[model samples]
Target: MNTSVVDCQKRLCPLRYLPRQPLSDPQASSQSASCVATSACESSALSFKRQAVRRSITPEFAKKVQSRSQVPVSRRSMRLQAIRPLRSLLHSKTTVSSALRPWGARGFASALVDKQVEGERITKVAELASEQAVRVTFEDGATAKFHKLWLRDHCRCEHCMHPETQQRQLDTASIPMDTPLHRLEVTDAGDAVAIDWDAPVRGTPCTASEFDAQWLRDHAYALEGGNAEDEDTAPYPKSYRQPRLTTQQLWAGADFQLPTHDYNKCVDNIEPLMRDLYTYGLVRVSDTPNSMEATEKFSKKIGFVLRTIYGTMWTTNPTNDAEGYNDTASTNLELLHHTDGTYIRDPPGLQIFNCAAQAGEGGESRYVDSFHVVETLRKENPEAFRVLSTTPLPYFTVDNDAHLATMEPLIRVDYAGNVVQFRHNDYDRAPLTHLSFEEVGEFYKVHRKLLEVLRRPETEFCMRLQVGDMMIVDNQRVMHGRHAFQGGDRALIGCYIGRTEYESRLRVLGII
Candidate 1:
């Protein structure tokens, strides 16, 4: 309602905004978000990459790189990315690198949130040993070191990246990993660097790439001298110099206020609601029409509802739907703190629940930020944390028509060891056959440990959802359930939204 999707996509689209490409399923967005996050992990991963380089380039460089290669292959093989441009300048008139311009776009919006503060331009270029990387220094003592293969892979020309889709066109694996640089120099204007490669990219002999100077500054991973693992990692930029949420507001019930907005007013704006939802994992809106129509309208303002076994729009009231729910959620039984769709590979990211009818007693809705819970587990019980994160468990839903199942760790984290998704639902669990005998015992032990942190009074928020009350929840990060109620009928109408769609709005608002 505040900013249209077209406006956001157009700003980033190299050409004109076109219809979004179709996704095969709801989880497609979640899968795609991982790829996007990995690509954007550049600036932060740089520090990690640099430490590996510093350790490997010993006085005995060749021997250490081989005999003493201690860095994990997973970390070493991670593609070091140049921060992507806000608007890919692939069509830029400059033809310096491989008939393409690289990571350039005037350093994003000149005054988005704040004036764009560009670092010093390229002052000098140095080719490090092993012919693996280049260090570009800036005028103001800032420096960025980039890998040779990474530079070739991220070239953003019409030949390398599709101009319309803004997706990579060049075959990354086909390119030589150690593509030697025939020549590398800072441009005369000091705003970009020009390079000529000795090996072919995707079998194309013409290997030349021009990288924007400001692009290098923002994306550059500065080298840090260290032979040991970093116990304390320095803070790194998360976006391409755009505004973003630096930290999630980990809270108990006391620190939150359920941000409320009337449905009528929300039609005019939804930014305030989104900001709160992203920070707190959930929020409540009042005075909404008690119908699925209103629920979907509110959902579409952010993104469309994800269709699943329960269909797009669903309800817990056994009286309302003829098909009837096959799950206990429709009954008057206390559901434990857990996420929905545990059987699906990528559980829904956001869940919208609009209470149409209320129960006179009990049936109070409950929520807990699993991110907060897991972080507590990390500190309070590091061993438990390791077990839950590394061990995989099976989840399943076997109905007459559908038999859905998947195996994954309960707490899914990213390369930086931050919680990305939480798939915890004891009720939906299948047999414990996925883990080894010893690991199975450990899983149960840690499961209890995690629940202890989860069920604490301060960590939970409980409220009886009332008529016209709507809740938006990050199902991936927040665990939600309800208490048993008897006397009055409790009905909740809701649907799910993918994580990809949720973060797209965050990007549009520059709040990622």
Candidate 2:
């Protein structure tokens, strides 16, 4: 047999399925079964190749091969004829061992099997190195050191985080600065990192809890100092910036039309609604059902309805009460521009109002972008702006059912000196008991100026909301009011939602 023919047979046969033989021994050729199998495989492979070449090659190539070939066609044909019996024996329906079957017939290839086994191996482990920190090692030989204080502060155990709400319960200040990790180990499956803390009482051992491996991976920070220049490259997402609007820019359109969507679309697909709320600070949904239940459902679609003294969902209509303690919203009187819940320390972040019945005349809704007003005040009168932003004002509401009092600056600025929240309500404001005589005079000066700017015709937009129209406003960024109506029945249902839940929905929808 030619050397090339033997080499081709070796390549064609599955190496694992072939019987072991010594390649150095020339006597190996005397093995009849192996020799027969090799010769049959070679003949079959050559036949398949010849058929492919005949179909694919041009006639000119066939002529060139016929003229240049040293071996006669008759000899080649004779060898093919001799291998016919062996080919028939190999192809016959006979029992074969599982090990002799081709690769992938019984299972995956060897390389793929190795890869899966490696992937299932343990990839993460944690060990207690000292009283100060725990060392975590990953599969790739990379390691991270987590401080004891950091680990205790971020523990997600039920005692640390509320099981139902997932809110943190542990107080950072209560945790000892010298808290020590007594024991640390990786779970057997390597899906979690378990840690045991040394309690003050030696007999009472702290319960062991597991931290998710992926969570640890996500929060891993480098122990070494990184480039200082990279810290201030871009602002974080939570950092506040002034709203992208001016009085002139917002009123440039023929009408101040906010982003509007159908009520059904707003409920079913909330991404666009969230985007609009983040951008314009207000959104309107048309054709809502005329009921308080519909308003509750609309608020729940984005976040839970915030229950206050007024209830989860409150109805506002003209009430003929002679009581002096009644809220301005309960009467059929024109309301000045104001945000709700200014008397609460943490006021509702979003407010929704749905018109269930239209007034016969003169109940136009008015809205002013507090962000734009703040920008104007900041530019025109920097001193007044500074006073409003820094000085806390008294806002209180006292009735038979509830007595709420809070002191917050009319304009709130974050650490970056960007305006974050605006809370103002002339009707609900209490006496300035905490400020001095000079401070009170300066505060009133700025307070009056802010209200003047808020009520300006160009600064506020007015619209008559028809029945079945709902408007959603960012209570922190926009102030709303209503015109007094006469000789008609007007009804509106309103609700509040927390800012954290609203922003969580936006994150889940990838709107922010």
Candidate 2 segments whose C-alpha is farther than 4 A from its true place: 1-255, 320-325
lDDT, residue 503, candidate 1: 72
TM-score of each: 0.75, 0.56
True-structure lDDT of candidate 2: 0.61
Consecutive 10-residue window with the lowest summed lDDT within model 1: 75-84
Query: lDDT scores for all predictions?
Result: 0.65, 0.61
RMSD of each: 14.1, 24.2
Candidate with the greatest TM-score versus the true structure: 1
Error of 2 at 222 (Å): 12
